[model samples]
Target chain A: MKDNIKKSYLLNIVGILSIYLILKLLIGGNVLNRYHISIVIFICINIILATSLNLATGFLGQLALGHAGFMAVGAYVSAITAVALKSSGLPDTLMLVISLLVAGIFSGIVGIAIGIPALRLRGDYLGIITLGFGEVIRVIINNMKSITGGAQGFTGIPRIANFDNVFWITIIVVGILYALTHSRQGRAIISIREDEIASEAVGIQTTKYKVLGFAIAAFFAGIGGGLYAHHLAFLDPKTFGFMKSVEILVIVVLGGMGSLTGSIIAAIILTILPEALREFANYRMLIYSFILVVMMIFRPQGIFGTKEFSLSSFLHKLRYNQIISPRKEIKGDE
Target chain B: MAILQTTELAIQFGGLRAVDNFNISINEHELVGLIGPNGAGKTTIFNMLTGVYRPTEGDIKLDGVSIVGKKPYEIVKQGAARTFQNIRLFKNLSVIDNIKIAYHNEMKYSTLEGIFRTKRYWKEEKKAHQESLDFLKIFDMQDYANTLAKNLPYGKQRKLEIARGLATNPKILMLDEPAAGMNPQETYELMDTIHFIRDKFNITILLIEHDMNLVMGICERIVVVDHGKIIAKGLPEEIKNNPDVIKVYLGE
Candidate 1:
């Protein structure tokens, strides 16, 4: 069993590295146009946002509708910091890293602040509280014209986030999240989702884990927001409204809440589906809504349910179960 | 010395007094049973002891320290663990994971260590896994370690709930109703398991059960209650013969 675990880890690393190399080669060879590159970047950002929200909503069993609020917080803070540091003779890369960190921490702190009071309620009450909080964030951003540029949207932000930078960052964020959900702390959060009363009876501080999960989800959402601000070189409070939060939630729900791979796959498909159907631009949202309704009616647990896709496990099942094994006389091949 | 002691424990729900003036003292390694009819406030007393519902008035002490108003998790940390009457297992999680969740307070690794899979993290996790498997072995549930809790047979689910509670290494293990849905054969087997656990762990047990046969079979001392008050307290033989107990069970 231990050997199998090690082999799977090695295989996953190799798989990811190969995919990254292939993408890099395609972009370098000019096989993909600028529009395609931008879309890939958007997919990466969406993956980060969806996976983070999955931690809170899917794993923790808490419904939060203000995720884009955290994203907006990260965007505005990072954008302001970047603008302030641009003329301070700092390296662009260093400034970008600092700004993203600021964005993540700021949003994480806000998550905790909201989670404290919001998590006191459960089910639809919690969802409604988070929704209100999201709107409150937008209103705050709108009124703070000095820093956020009010209704005009914050501008003059540096564009440092590219395909390469975001790709690596997204990998890091997703990797950390995956590791978290598989760890002891992650188990505590999952138990809360399974049965909150039983979780408490088993010596788990349900409130603490709930707040921690919410804060971490907000942290990553903020990071994605920072990347967005840099990529667009502009920010609009209107863009991070309730509907934006709904879009991220839609990706998470469609991907299967507790499955990171599901989020990633759903993020890619949902991001590109509209672009692929651009001829029906006027009915873009209508088409998207129709797909979502159909998906819910058929598979309410999302595409993957709570199961993760493992390449090693799939290969093992195929080789051992489906294919008949020959006489085991040549077993020393390894 | 008494491992658990409750005095003047009471809780009121608006105009209703759910449990009033409930008092009990359990010594170390004692197998005590609390039995009463439905709505007799038996579970309410259990709730107060486990910190699910704070008593409107009274003091509960574990090893002589008052635990009143403490959170359920805090109470567990103070060496008290409990199983619910309705079999509250982590239904979606594996049986082994359910046991591991109980060992949360005992795990020493931090979140950072867990995220990075540091050496300490791997070591602690391996230890926890082995310990959990050993627990399953005691219940003869090692084979079902990977099975989801909800998929287990009714008897096994009850047994798993007890095993999960025992994983906390509590000084006092409170069981709300271990045989509520079990067959007679399963109930008989549960009697032996409860006795074995009490001897093996040397922990105090306070169980709330409705099955008189199971209660009489295992509990060394039994307390009978009716209408939020203790009606009789003695050996199972004495309680079976007590006039007040007869009145409560037979309804005047």
Candidate 2:
């Protein structure tokens, strides 16, 4: 078991480095242009968003709809922080890191504020309250022109969150999230999802776990927002509206809730697919949604269901051709 | 010494007194059966005892401390745990994980320790894993440890629920119709399991079962309720012969 853990850790580091190096090489050689590089960065940002949202909507088993509200808070907070820190003579990278942290912490605080009240309501009520709160955030940002620049959009951000920063951030964030979901705390969170009453009956503080999960999810969504703010050097209250929230939800649902690997894979495919289909022009959205509907009808559990895609397991299966379901084997034996 | 005591505990759902004047006292290591006909407020009493419902009328004392309006999880932490009448395993989780969740509160590692994977995380996690396996071993369910709860056979599911309830390390474990769906052989095995667990864990047990053979065969004392009232209370044989119990439940 120790050896397996070591092997997986080594494999993960190698895999991450390879992807980074390949992308870096592409950019250096100009195989991918500026527009394509931006799309890749967007994929990373969206992966962060989808995985963070998955913690609440997937692992926590709550239908949260206002994730964008948290992201909006992060973007605005980080943008403002960066603008203020610009004249402080700090190194660009350090300033960017601090701004992102501030963004995440503030977003998490807001998440806790909203979560305490909103989490008390379950299922659809929770969803609606989060949605309402999300809209409230957008409207507040829209009205607070002096600070947010309101409907006019906030620009002149540092543009420090390049592909170099975002790819690594996405990897680190997802890795931390993976560790979290596989731990003792993650069990409490998942148990709530599996059976809330049973979880409560077994001495889990359901309300505390729910709020904790919500706050963590919100915190990462804020980090994703911070990355976006600098990458594009812009912030639009309109970008963090209801439709944007839906866009992130679509990615998570498409990836299979509770599966972080699914979120990353789905985020990549969904982000790149539209860009690849830009030639279709007017019929693009219709085609994209049509594909989604078909995918849902055919495979409703999304790409991976609730199962994590394991590279080791996949390789073992390839070698041995063994069946995965123990129940099936037991039934057959009987 | 009463480990669990409830006095005049009652709840009314919109003027319908579902359970009124309910009183129960069980000593440590006692295996007591709560028997009642359908809709006799047996489950409701369980709910109130476990803090699922706040009783409008009386007080519940666990180990001589009043526990009214405390949440169900809090009650579990205070040395009480219960299984549902309808089996409610974490169906999506593995069998061992179902038990591990009951051990959630007892594990001391913080969330930050979990995220960072400190040495304490591995030490505690390894201990939890081995112990959870030990728990499954008592039920002789070690082989099915990795199987999802939903995929388990009906009898095994019932046993798993009992295992999950016991996992909380409760002073008094409550079983709600544990043998409800089991065959005769399974019920016999469950009866033995019930007796074994009560002695092994050295905990009091409050059982709500319709199977007279299992309940009467194992329960040291029996309390019978009918229409939200205690019809009779005594040894299982005494309750079996009691006129009120016979008229309401036995139906001679």
Candidate 3:
């Protein structure tokens, strides 16, 4: 069983590294242009946002709607930190890491601050609270002229979140989320999602796990915001508004709630779909909405439907030459 | 000595008293049953005893600790776990995972440790996984470990719910209707399983059942309630012949 675990881990590592190296080679060879690289970075950012939100909305069974507000907080905090640290004579990589961490920490703290009061409510009540809180954060950033530049937007952040850096950052964040979602803490959170009352009766503290999930999701959203700020070299408060939260949520729902790999795949497709449809001109969004409507009417559980894609499952399918349904039970070493 | 004892326990919802003056005591390793007709407040007593509902007046001592203001999870941690009147297994989670989730408080590891995949996380998780399997083996559910709780047959779901509650290592197990939707054969099987678990775990049990045969067969003692009050309390034979119980059941 342990050997099976090791082999599967090896497969996953190889799979991830090959993808990263291919992207790196594409950029090195200029096979993909600057516009494509920017899109790739955006996809990475979306993956981070989607996976974190999946932790809260998917695994914890929450309906948080203020994700963009946390992202905005991270962007402003990291941008300011990068600007402050740029003159410290540190390596660019070191500065990027520090700013991202600071951004994540501040956003997570704000998450806890809001979560304490907000998490007390459930279902639509929590969603409304988070939506209102998210807008409030954006408004605060828009009004604070001394610090946030008001609605004019903060400019000239150090552009350290290039594809080379952000691709790896995205991998690390996703890895952390996967590890979390597969452990005891993850099961506790999932149990709360299944039935809050049953979970409490079974000795799982629902409120703590709910808040923990919310804070972690906020933390990752902040990290994604930090990456975006550096990638764009500017901070636009308007960019992280209600619609932005809806977009991230759409990725999560499109992927499949309670399925991490589904979230990743959905984030990738949704992020690139608009660019891929640019040939349609004015009909791009029309086509996109049409697909979403069709998808909802057909497969409302999302693409994966609470199931994940895994290397072992993929290998088994290839060897057997048949599609095997996703199994929940993985042997030891999981 | 009584492992679980409640004194004058009562709860009122607005103008209506849901359960009042409900007193019961189960000694260590005792199997006691609570029964009454529909809306007779049997479940309300379970709710108050399990901390789901705070009694308007009275004290509940679990292992001699006053658990009046504690939350449901805290009560479980204090060594009292319960199953709902309705089947409340984590429907989407695997059967093994449902048991493992009950082991959450028992396992000692931080969220950071779980995220980092630290040594302690693996150690605790492996122990939990193996123990959950062994735990499932008792109910002969090892074959269904990977099956989702909702997919289990109705009888197995009730058995699974009981098994999940036992995973909490509670000193006392409060079951609110373990045979709600089961046939005679399944009810007999549940009776055997409940009897076996009480002996194996050496824990006190308080059961609420509308199925009088199962209750009278397994329960050493019985408490009957009607209209938010205890109508009678004694040995099963006495409860079987109680005039008040017959009146409550058959009407006037």
Candidate 4:
């Protein structure tokens, strides 16, 4: 397995170099330098949000519109934690990592609390409940004058989150998610998604798995929120309101509900596409809505639609690299 | 001695009583059949036994222990397992996975062990998969280990559902309309499989079947019902000869 991975890694390096050259040429050096770092950062954050939501919407087949509420919980928790411990003067990297993890756990707990009752609902009822819950969370934050500062926003947050931190954490979280979705738990979630009744008959404990999926999604959304809070050094309840929830939902839908790579690609495109067309900034929201509508019409399942782009499939085409053909019959000499 | 007994087991659906004072006693190693015309509450009885619905009023005892008011999973843990009248295999999962899921209740590893993929978790998972494979091999379905349940042939899908039920390692396996969708050959094969499970696993079976031939061929005892009441209970030959059984069957 190691040898196979090594060979694949070598090939991937070559592949990545070619793609980088192509991207560099298409958009000139100066523009790429200025926008590339931020675009990558946005892509990472959107991937976290999309993939996490997939755990609920795609795997568990629950449509939750309040993911941003969980994200807000994480962001605020992490922001408060960082600020409270500011006097201790912890290292920035360590503080950032700890804050993100704390945020994830906090959001996961809130997720479990919300999911228990909310997931009992089915179809559009679940959607409505989640939407209402999202608004409720925002209102609570807006009213909490002492802790959340009542709409003035939480400022002076430590700016420990940068492109590198965002990139690595996103990679790790996505990697963990990929592993989970392929595991037995992942299969069980997918099974529940396909048919909850059959899943229960097969002794799946469907509600437990559904709640588990929701908690996981919320955990990462929180982490993503923590990343967001630290990146901007400021946050408000409005930042993680219903429209923000819709923004993340757009990412999940446009990327294909079950397609991780599609989500990542969609994230990058959605983030940068607007700024590239900056002259039409007034119509930015309009363009975003239009793109989603067009994509829905053309390919409702999104770009990949639950299938991943396999480098192995591509490498199989270069069969000239193999010493022995896979199809060849090797028998004892006659 | 009877491993499972139901006394006056009944279910009421709105204005109508679906099952009225239905009683059954299944001894260890017996293959029993419950037959009735449509809407006669044969499936309703199975549902009651499986805890999908609580009995309107009756005592269901497994080994003399009352299982009344217990949940479906609670009944399952008490040495009873069942298949749905319509096959309810976990569709998106692999054939092996469908069976392994039934073994989830038997797992000894904690969630912490599962998350870290600890040694205990690996051992339990390995054993679970092995047991699932062994169960599938009984139905000659080990080759389709990776095939999704929905992708299997109809006959194999039915067999997979039974395998999943068997994976629970129940003392009594209840199959609802097991031969509902099969041709004669498949039905015959299923009959053999039912006997194989009974003899090999030393488990009793209470089956609700629509096919008279398959039911009569394997069931040591038969209970016939009509309009939610037992019309006759005896050996197959006696059930076949009973006047009321004939009237209920032929709609006389």
TM-score, second chain, candidate 4: 0.97
**Residue A18 of model 2: what lDDT?**
89
After TM-score superposition, what is the CA distance of residue B79 in candidate 3 from its true location, in Å? 0.9
Give the residue spans of candidate 2 off by over 4 A.
A323-334, B250-252
- Tell me each candidate's TM-score: 0.96, 0.97, 0.98, 0.88
| lDDT of candidate 3 over A212-275, digit per residue (tens) | 9999999999999999999999887899999999999999999999988899999999989999
Error of 1 at A55 (Å): 0.6
Q: DockQ of each model against the real complex? A: 0.61, 0.72, 0.88, 0.32
* A1-334: candidate 2 lDDT, tens digit per residue: 6666776577667777888999999999999899989999999999999999999999999999999999999999999999999889898778888999999999999999999999988999999999999999999999999999989999898888888878888988998898888788999999999999999999999999999999999999999999999999988888898998999999999999888888989999999988888999988888899999999999899888787776555555688998464222111010
Task: Write one digit per residue (lDDT tens) for candidate 1, span B1-252.
Answer: 999999988899999998888888999999999998889998888888888998889899999999999999999999998999898999987898899999888888989998888888777877888999999998999999888899999999999999999999899999998999888999999999999999899899999999999999889999998999998899999999998988888878
Task: Give the per-residue Cα lDDT of candidate 1 at A230.
Answer: 93
Top lDDT model? 3
Clashing residue pairs for model 3 = none
Per-residue lDDT tens digits for candidate 4, residues A1-334, read 3355456546645665575566557446465574576666667787899889887897688999998898898889899988887778898878998988899999999999999999998879999999998899889988988887779999899888876567668867775776566445766687788777666665567788889999999999999989888887888888888988888888888887776667777888888787777788799878877888899999998887765544544456466565332111111000
- Overlapping backbone residue pairs in candidate 2 total 0
Sort by lDDT, top down from the best:
3, 1, 2, 4
Where is model 2 chain A poorest over a 10-residue stretch in terms of lDDT? A325-334
